[model samples]
Target: MRIDLTNIPSEGKSLHFTLTPDWWKSDLDEDRLMGLEAPLSASIKLYPAGKKIAVEGSLSTRLVMRCDRCLEPYGWDLSTDFRIYLSIAPFKGELDVELSEDDLSLDFIDGEFLDPAQIIREQIILSVPMKTLCRKDCKGLCPVCGCNLNMTRCSCSSTYETSLYQNS
Candidate 1:
């Protein structure tokens, strides 16, 4: 939803919004989030300051991820919280400098309607974790016997969970 800052308060205005999962386009990362089969849900607050908008909120969703050690699909929960500022000032020849959000600085965009879908895409991408695990001591599938060691036993001298990291 677009927040027209034409006549907002100087001290900023408090606004709350909830966005559903259907608002986003599917951006599946085959490598991450397992098979990339889930969408993010958003709850946010906006504080408008002149032509600047400060956003803070959280998005939660369920992810199907591959077990880092076993290569099996597992259910993983993911959530992303964001606190960022965006400037919606009109472009004038008076200033031609690049904008940034470093160290809680500033980011500039066209002084037009803001697309909520774009905001969601950015938030979701930034929230993904670099690494994920099924469990701290997950006994993954057996390599030799092709059995899920966590659920079944293997007779062959197949690799075990504890042995996988013995060298490390």
Candidate 2:
């Protein structure tokens, strides 16, 4: 997973690898909201740009995502391309320096080693949707009975007053 910068040839270096669900399970935290339904295919190309390294890659996989509304597991196909610039030199500027638009795409590295696994992991995590839903009209779970409304109707009263703005 770690590539030595010095080993990269003058022209460039290309890497291809398959990341399994087990890899993600071990890398991700205990509260991970997503799972890999299939092995992820990754392709990366590294180019040396003076003191900086340019990484371009693509990832494709099937992910098992939990729907936020229904709390059900659903399959989602993922395919995305990414480009990252790595600066080998550490910035010596002031800590309070403002970042420009170009600086947003740049990453700083301490040593000559690059961990592609970490980059792939980050890309996968960033691809997760903020609001996950299995369907557009998910009924969700009943507040009182905790029953999935999408499956069956609960006998609990549906009319409930909002207590959030109530004067206490």
Candidate 3:
């Protein structure tokens, strides 16, 4: 999904589209997003601002992910509304110039085209949680017998459990 910013009007153009599971290939190394449980719907409005462009939109989708603890599959719902300002002109300042606070979120356009796929991929990556668990109270697996604690209780003495977390 590329948007040509060369002829964008001052009032901007509003566009709406859907991203299906077949549209994108996962590039994550580990704990990757398996697929989309529902279609991803996006609505964006691009407008010209000076030598830059402003992008504002919202995207929502339900993703299938693998649990880090039990390695089981699960569904996670994600939705985000983003506002970004892009600059098409190159910065001619010195190489050693220090960045201001506003430079943190500023984006640069490439050849008068705005690649929405890159933006969507970045947003999805940022939205991923550091830790993925099926549930907060997940008992996990038994260290001795490798039994799922959530399913069945192991006969390994309770002392083993007490000693495991004592040092931590």
Candidate 4:
């Protein structure tokens, strides 16, 4: 959803919306590893701070993620809060400029509108864990037979030797 900058009153604006799984499927990339199990509830408040706009929001939802260890899909609950400051892009011409420490923290908007969907999408992606696991004690798959060890025991022996260099 796009919010017009000019429409925001001096008193500020507050918005509440629900983002659906279908919206995520369409907005996210095709290789997205996770899916939304339920609709996400988001609330955002926008305030004009000097020449910049400040946005504060919170979201909660259930996500369907794949386990890295067992390669199984599992549900996870997610709740997060975020804050960002947006300003109009200062550089219009094609010129290389060095960025400072303060420049790295703020978000730049292109036109006179701000897209909250983009912010939510970025937050959701950043919230995901690097290593996903269905359970801590997952046995994973057997190397020899490619069988899921968590489901059933395999006949493959676990005593496999390893060497840095093999004589060929």
Clashes of each: 0, 0, 0, 0
Q: Candidate 3 — which pairs collide?
A: none
Candidate 3, residue 46: Cα displacement in angstroms equals 1.0
Q: Candidate 1 regions off by >4 Å?
A: 1-30, 34-41, 89-111, 159-162
Candidate 3: regions farther than 4 A off: 29-32, 90-110, 158-168
In order, candidate lDDTs are: 0.56, 0.70, 0.68, 0.69
**What would the TM-score be for candidate 4 when compared with the true structure?**
0.77
Per-residue alpha-carbon lDDT of candidate 2 for residues 1-168, written as tens digits (9 for 90 to 100): 678765678789999999888777533432335678999999999987776667889999998888776688888899999887665545542112122233232232325667787777777767778777777766777667778788998787756212311311
User: Model 4 scores what on Cα lDDT?
Assistant: 0.69
- Looking at model 3, report the run of 10 residues with the lowest lDDT sum: 93-102
Q: On residues 38-149, what C-alpha lDDT tens digit does candidate 3 reach at each position? A: 8888888888766667778888998887776556678899999877666654554111211223333223234566677566655675677887877876666667887777
lDDT of 4 by residue, 127-158 (tens): 77877778876666666787777898877775
Worst 10 residues of 1 by lDDT: 101-110
- Total backbone collisions, model 1: 0
Judged by whole-model lDDT over C-alpha atoms, candidate 1 comes out at: 0.56
RMSD of each: 5.2, 5.9, 4.8, 6.1
Q: Write candidate 1's Cα lDDT for 1-168 as tens digits.
A: 565534445665554455554554444653654433456566656666445666666777766667766667787776777776655447541212222433221122224444444555566555556656678776766767768777788786744545766732
Could you give the candidate ranking by lDDT, starting with the highest?
A: 2, 4, 3, 1
